[model samples]
Each structure stands twice: as structure tokens, then as C-alpha cells.
Target: MRNLTQTVTRWAPTGTDAAGDPIGYTRTEILGRWEESQQLFTRSDGTEAVSRAIVYLASDVAVGDFLLQGSSVSASPPSTAWRVEAFRKVENLRGTDSERRAML
Candidate 1:
């Protein structure tokens, strides 16, 4: 993780309303520490994907949850969001304090 930290708002699904429509994710939103990087990830099926950013929090998250982040520029109000496509966890190391990596 990098020292350049940013705020992340995670929106999780709550439930539905009267007409079987999706309701609020207000109570489901969670804030976390996020960092931006330029790392590419490889999948089990031999496919490659790029992750625009990363979340450093340890809380669990599901697919389709919204990830909100403020723009990098200081004087700009533009922000971006992404859906959780998938996540991967890797473990094992020779000599390092960190032994695991969680990629999304």
C-alpha cells in the first residue's frame, strides 16, 4: 500500500421494496482506505486484467458493490466508481513481513 491514501465508499445491497424493487444501500455503505497503483493481474483462466486502483481495507465485499473514489487532482471534483468484478488472494513468501496479497 502507498502513503497516498484516498477515501472509498462501498455500497452494498440491502433489500427490496414493496414492488420487488431494490431498496436502499444507505445502511450498507462502508468507508475504507484505498490506494491507486498501476499493476496488472492475471486470472486462473489465463486472462489478463487491469485494476485501476485497490482497496486496503480488510472487510469483505461482494460483486456488484459500488466503489466510489474522489478525483486525484486537488482542485477537481470529478470522481470515479467501479463494480467489483472479481477478487484473488495469493499467499506465500520467502523473506518479507507480508505473506499475502489480495487483488481485485
Candidate 2:
């Protein structure tokens, strides 16, 4: 059997705007998977944008376990929410025997 591990990190905006209006955003990063690879998507200022998403996998992350941050936007809330528009695979590490071996 093959042992597979995956981790995702996401961010979103949750706070009041300049006029004290509620707003939010979202983003996600996935590792050790084929369909969803290393990529980060985000929406800021009510606009959507895509950028290179980088991630590192360690033994600390387990399935169904997620780390989240949240706070007030006006006061530079330590926890901000971002909106996720889309995701694409920029790099994949799982392939044939030789490719897998090279990764190790």
C-alpha cells in the first residue's frame, strides 16, 4: 500500500473596511497531491489575483488537521481571511519509481 500525505494552508479576510464595512477573502495551498498542487489564490480589495504558492511538508501536519488565523481588520488583525478564486498545479512530486526515488 502507498502512504499519502497532504497539507493545505488557507487565508481569508474578515473585518471592516475603511468605512467600517464587513469584508473577507480566501486562499489555499495543497501539497503531496496530483489534482491540486502548489499554488496560491487570493482576493484582496475585492479584486482577484493569482501568485506562486509555495509549501513545505513536515510530520507535524496530519489529515483533517488545519491551522487557522483570525483577527480584526481595522487593528491589523493577526488573523485575516482571503477569498480563493481558483487553484492550479504548478509542480507535482509524485510520479514513476525513478521520479519518486529522485525526490527522496
**lDDT on C-alpha atoms for all candidate structures:** 0.51, 0.32
lDDT of model 1 at residue 97? 29
Which candidate tops lDDT?
1
Model 2's TM-score against the true structure: 0.21
lDDT of 1 at 32: 51
Misplaced by over 4 Å in model 1 are 1-7, 14-31, 43-46, 70-79, 89-104
What TM-scores do the predictions have?
0.49, 0.21
For model 2, residues 5-40, the per-residue Cα lDDT tens digits are 554343334555898654653334433322324343
Which residue pairs show backbone clashes in model 1? none
* Candidate 1 lDDT by residue in tens digits, 43-95: 55677777776665434566545566643322211235566555543432654
What are the C-alpha RMSDs, in order, of all predicted structures? 7.1, 11.8
Supply candidate 1's per-residue lDDT for 2: 41
